[model samples]
Target: MYRFIMSLMLVLPVSVFSALNYLQEDITNDTTWTIQDSPVYIYGNITVKNGATLTIMSGVEVYFMLVEGDGGFREGSELYIADGKLIAEGTQLLPVIFTSGGDIRSDGDWGCIAVEDDSVVNLNHCVIEYAKAGLIFWNLSSMSEMASSVNYCRIYHSSEVGILFYNSSPTINFNSIKNNRYGIQTQGLSSPTVNYNDICSNYSYNFRNLSGLNQDATSNWWGTTNINEIEANIYDYYDNHNYGVVDYTPFLESSYFNEGGIGDKSLGWLRSIFVP
Candidate 1:
């Protein structure tokens, strides 16, 4: 009886392992997911077909592993939600992360996360950083064109613009956007409710208004020198939130340090508040 019990235990373990492998293989062979040429790269530029709910699972690290010499990325490697809703709903602990497989220390690496007009992108608890830009919304024709809202996300270390709302009116609330060229750009008639965000010293304007009618409301912290321009809702040369001055640290060292030891105190506030 003892010999038979030991044999059963060994057989059960093998069977369970085999079952798990089979399940994994079945998922790998799923026709829904199309693996691109680069194993780590995936494209979302193509129009999201109707009746298909594309869900990217947690702990899945999708990187834009396109190098400069390797013909570069084919226009849209990041995300281009032209029509359908791209739901990247991640939890606080298991936030869906999108990163560029470039040197983390280097500047200007990958592209942006552009969700076009009229499309619903429910992105929560995601870390979209170290790319070209964080979120690029293009609906500049009018204020009503703005449609997306990013909540509880950390958008940092982007190449150019952090969160660029070109012509779209997006309610950018409760996000930590830092260390980029332009922190948050609102051009044309995109009058988003910019409140409760830690938009600190990017390269150029922290929050710029190209169209004179753009309304940059209140309750948010703009850590640029041109705080008056964004605060008073005025347009001027000095109002340009130029140069990284959130804490005088990123300008010296390429590395970005959160408000902890020797950085500016305001940056800590910017990193804390959530507009939502």
Candidate 2:
């Protein structure tokens, strides 16, 4: 009977058991992560270099190993895209998820998806959480043609800044940024359009402008309608002269989130984004 069972195991289909796609090495060539290969695990730092493209289809859940350290990508896992293109587009129903491994979750569990250099980035309808920093755009080469955009996304639970733009100007809109140390921080000549977002309930300031350039941060819901309470959460020229002013007038009094958990611009119709 034992010998017959051993032979039967060899004949059975591989789908009888679990299937996992483990990634440890760097992605040098163009790669595509599909929904069939759901739950793609990354052990360490994965860099998408120049001329390469990494596409993650909808409903593809990505887990990064979280090794606590110096708040950098030393032992912790990270997805660094520099001089490459990353198109991670998820739908309103099933969005892409980037979270830490294991069941329990916390902030700074992993590093982040660092979009730098002359890379082409499109992070639409995605959910990113439990990171030291959700998205960091640093010194991107192009100002217009190569400008990166993030839309209809929810970024939260970051120990540091949710979105940090340094010397790079990226388009950020229609996102729910909450429960972070700093919701958004811009520095070093960064000129980003921060509009139509639910920038609420951050630990520190919601928007911090370190650069001298003025920022247009209008039409965002800062969790409250009280004018004094709203400006209290913003860090800019009023606090320090060197820093630029964050014009957050014409703010949304209350969130217009629909039943689908999306804040629609047109009465909150609900659109695409990541995570559950």
Candidate 3:
């Protein structure tokens, strides 16, 4: 009898372990996503309404579903914050993961984490990948006191831009931004404090400033320290006099690449062997 009961337990479906599957919904009140209910699936857009807070605990895996066709903006899943707050704090050993649900995943597989309208967001020790844009701050007024910060995160494999700012200033530091079309892009008077990051090997320009506003991006490792090589990888005022300049002077002497880190682990064991 004991052996039969043990055998039945082994044959149980994997869904038995899953806690909650959140479909398309609006978070109107304060909510906490805990680690116990891990591997949460977001089937549709998750909009955090005004004055609400969504707290994500450590080691939580948030998977966004893939939408078909070019109308990803209208159909794909995303985390949208408008006049709300998002606090996602994770530890080094067990960081949070935001990834796609499709089996054949690539860049732009899903939408992005978009923050707008005086929303406050803080992401630490997280891994965000396979999206149009990993993080985007848009339409924030100059007088707004609410600020966003992304630190110690791995944002990669984006089809469009890893981090984009549209008339918003966010503090971005100590992150690994790589393997995307554009590592970071700013427009419309957006001046972000971008420093201490490993921004490298993007398909196009590593950094681009289109608003004609000078950006202070110092002390970063651009895969190489050669001034000429780094300048060639960036599209700024140097490329066009009308555009803003990315001050990449005094670059880091050594590469701050951390192996076996957040996003590195998600790249799969076989792929990481050749693609790092």
The Cα error of candidate 2 at residue 249, in Å, is: 1.0
TM-score of structure candidate 3: 0.83
Candidate 2 collision pairs: 125-273, 125-274, 126-274, 127-274, 264-268
Query: Mind giving the per-residue lDDT tens digits that candidate 1 earns over 99-194?
Result: 765434344455666666666566677778777777877763453434567777778887777776656777777666777777776665566666
Model 2 worst lDDT window (10 residues)? 267-276
lDDT, each prediction: 0.52, 0.78, 0.78
TM-score for each of the candidates = 0.62, 0.83, 0.83
Which segments of candidate 3 are over 4 A away from where they belong?
1-19, 69-75, 143-146, 257-276
Worst 10 residues of 3 by lDDT: 259-268
* Number of clashing pairs per prediction, in order: 5, 5, 0
Per-residue CA lDDT of candidate 2, range 58-144, in tens? 999998875555344333688988768889999988899998874578898888888776676888889999988899887744353
